[model samples]
Target: MAAERVEKRGEEEAQTRLPDLSFVHDKLQKFQSKMVSDFEQRLSCMVEDVLQDLRQRELRAHEFPNFEKSDRKSTWHNRVTNQAPADVSDAPNGHANGTQPRPPLQSETSVRKQRRQLPEKVFVARESYLTALLQVEHMRTIYHIFYIILVMFLLNVICYDYFVDGRFDLGLGTFRGGLRRLHWVLGVWLLEHVFVLALYFAFRGWALVRHRLKPHSSLQRFWSHSCLILYISSQLVFCFVSTSLCLKFNLPFVSACVLLLESTRLLMKMHAFVRYNAERVLNGKAKKEDAQEEKEASGRPFVPPLSCYTYFLFAPTLIYRDSYPRTSHIRWKFALNRLLEVVAIAFLYAFIHERHIHEHFGQYGLEPMGPSQLILKLFGMMLPCAVIFLCGFYLILHSWLNFTSELLRFGDRMFYKDWWTSHTYDGYYRNWNVVVHDWLYEYVYKDMYTHVFRGSKVGASLAVFMISAVVHEQVLGFALQMFFPVMFFLFGVVGVALVFLMRSAPKVMGNIFLWFSLILGNATLISLYAMEHYALKNCSLSNRSWTDRLLPAVWRCYN
Candidate 1:
């Protein structure tokens, strides 16, 4: 009996160790059965990406057919969306058996590209045009544009301040003498308009590309937000630190520029509150609806938004007063907070004024500087003196830059209460506050995009962008403003927000239009603001009275 038990155990062990012929046969058969689809599906993604890189590089039509892609698909090709090639078009869905003839995949070295993923790999593009752009095989070439622009600005500033001084010489001569003055105006304009929003916009793009690459896992998003935070924070630290250092002591322009470029690591600390809020809003809505359905079976209340169109009646309530945290909800809090912020600001300013007012009487403020002088003063405040660089940094570290918060607050409310505020909705947070608006788009909008628009990534991507631009404009004003910033910011933000629009309804489609209005209105408003600031700043010289300054600022609307 012992020998028989040993023999049975040995036979069972042998059976377990042996490969299963039947299982292998089943797998091989299944693979062969789906071989066409597997081959075509992969080929579809590859071919689409290759052709897309071609079309983007503006390669002339090759052997590929001029098939009619959806309008949204064409737009996706134009816009900077991070969607898979197959997902962008219907080519894969229509793919049939061996009889079906599809576009041949190009093998150009420049045409190849690997999607932007964290675990990186070098791409071998098939085409030469893109090959030059991506010689090292990286993500999109837009970064090159930013790099070139930065270099040009610095060079122009350097040449103007040191060399040109006013010589009608050749090459960079014209730009040399005028550089300082131009820098005064341009710097003021940039500090006012571009600097604060630059990183936020860039992060919007980074987030989109990340969403495209990673279709699964929520935790990986931490890496995405981290990348954004790094990029943005780099800009702020580099600019502030460099300027703070340079103005105090004369550092070589080369050293300053190099330091600014390198040390300015990317850091985008965009808010996650928006995403969490949207998630809760959406999840809560669905769960409530589900519970309501169950309760209805037990005879409970049923509430609909009256009619599809009538939903607008509840729009304000839905966005502002819902249990959810919304822009409107935040704005009211911000407004009240800003009021206290103003009082604190005024107290601080007044304390400084009282001290300085005794030394220079009423001239303690920027009274010595005329309008242009005031700009120079503001410009000086924005940048740091090489000598006082550390002092100022330390001071700001301790005291919040003395008066900057108040100044920004004063300016913000002034602008908000001006003629433009009527053109927009009541609350600043709803969308006017670009900072928080970007936060909403990234966290809230992006979540919806990845989950809802699983199949048609590109269309959903562009729609959200377009919608954001259009709505922001209509609400902000189309007749007065240009739409690029609104477009740029909204495209970035809405592209962010609409990432969720896939599972969203046409009502939810309102995000698109809101973004549109934001794009048009804000772009125009800011453009008008900066141009007016530059054009009429001199007007203050002619008139110091309230009406003089106010009139000139208003007249800037025309030119």
Candidate 2:
């Protein structure tokens, strides 16, 4: 009876421990398999890389025969001497000690040396013929046409305002109102600089602290993480405060837009700075293991130069680099031309807003509308809307950015590519805003592809589009003080679909499609938004319902 009880107890204990042991065994097996797979993949990549190096060497040899021969001879002699056995000697008959000579073996160092000797390929910005034409003296006669048309429009607007309103004002009342709000705008601008300067100093101080600490220690890592969180939190607080002030003060639309845009840019700069430095620190740590030199592993934390950071704040780029290609001198005449163009375009925008946009859509719900009337209204607004769109693009992306770049002598003038002539929607998106696109590509797309989606290009692409669309919609919605999702839908859905479709189409057809889509999309946005904006102002609702307030007024203007 005692033996039976002892046996039963033993059996129960064995059964209880079996599952735990098996679970651990299963985990180990999985880990082993993963390690093997990763090792195989790495080995395969290394082999491929070596093969590619050989092929490139062959191509270079064909292109430069004399240089290639000299390189080959030197490499062969080094290999033969270094690797040859002490007993073996070179014979006159190309033999070693009466035996056939061994073949020359390429060393990893020699391959690296060859790679280092290869010339680096330089990238040049490709501008369209039209952009180049704008620089020519004779072609610049085209500017006078726009100037003449602008003057005529101004005259007509002045006459209409004076005759209709019995006032000789050129909308100076709005200008004066904006000026009154200018002090608030300047205050917010100053606050942003203060926040940025504080963040920079914080980073510098943390770097100094890190340099004094032991590498990879728990205390050091904890402090580093704490500082990172603090910097990010501070930036978030700054953005929140800045945005609240802009909304609270009811700043001018353009002024609010500029403030928000600059705030976003500063945040981007901080992110870039942190990301770049973090990578450099990680790389430094990684190289330390294989460095074999005391100088290479001196244990100093990576800290970016203050001047580089300052320059990046003013530079027309999102990417952070220690330095950039620069021109020797500023082009004063070109800078002046661009600045003047920006001012002229600003006035042109104001005139359009005062005359055409307001006149057509100011009384949307006051009048009964038929389909024909709506169609005519949209058609009439299309040309003016297109002109506004083009002028805004030229003013900001080309004129303003280029002017700043020239003043700083920044050499990368390709702020935008030839987006006007882009054959595909994907191409257009890439070329339209190279600065923003680079940020998205590096941080969003690449990060998603690497970490989240794990190499799913489609998933990564979708993430990028979603992020871009949301940011764009946020900008427009906040600036306009409206909750319209028209731009969001167009950007995220229609634009993405067009990217895929236009990707495979022929150049001519794709370009035509691109332009047609642009025209239609811009027209639709202007028409719908304008109608809704005016309807909200002019229409009086019978019942103050949630639907009436939340939904677009264009849908129920008659109600």
lDDT of 2 by residue, 427-514 (tens): 8998787778878876777678878988688999999999889878777667666678898999999999888877867666788988
How many clashes in each candidate? Answer: 58, 0
Residue 331: error of model 2 in Å?
2.2
Residue 270 alpha-carbon offset, candidate 2, angstroms:
1.8
Question: What is the per-residue lDDT of model 1 for residues 1-559, given as tens digits with 9 covering 90 to 100?
Answer: 9999999999998787666866788899999979978898889867876876678445323221122222323311211222221211112222211112334664445233323211111111111122123333242355355345435544554465457455422223322422323333334334433443453344445544544454455754666667647755665564454445444443333233333322221112212322322343223232244776676534221222223212212221111111211111122443454354334433332222222222222322223434574344334332112212222222222123113323222111111111112222322233233322333344334544556765354654455555556444432322222222444454456445543443332222444554445444433433333334344433344555655544534343332
Q: Cα-based RMSD of the predictions, in order?
A: 28.8, 17.3
lDDT of 2: 0.72
Candidate 1 TM-score to native:
0.22
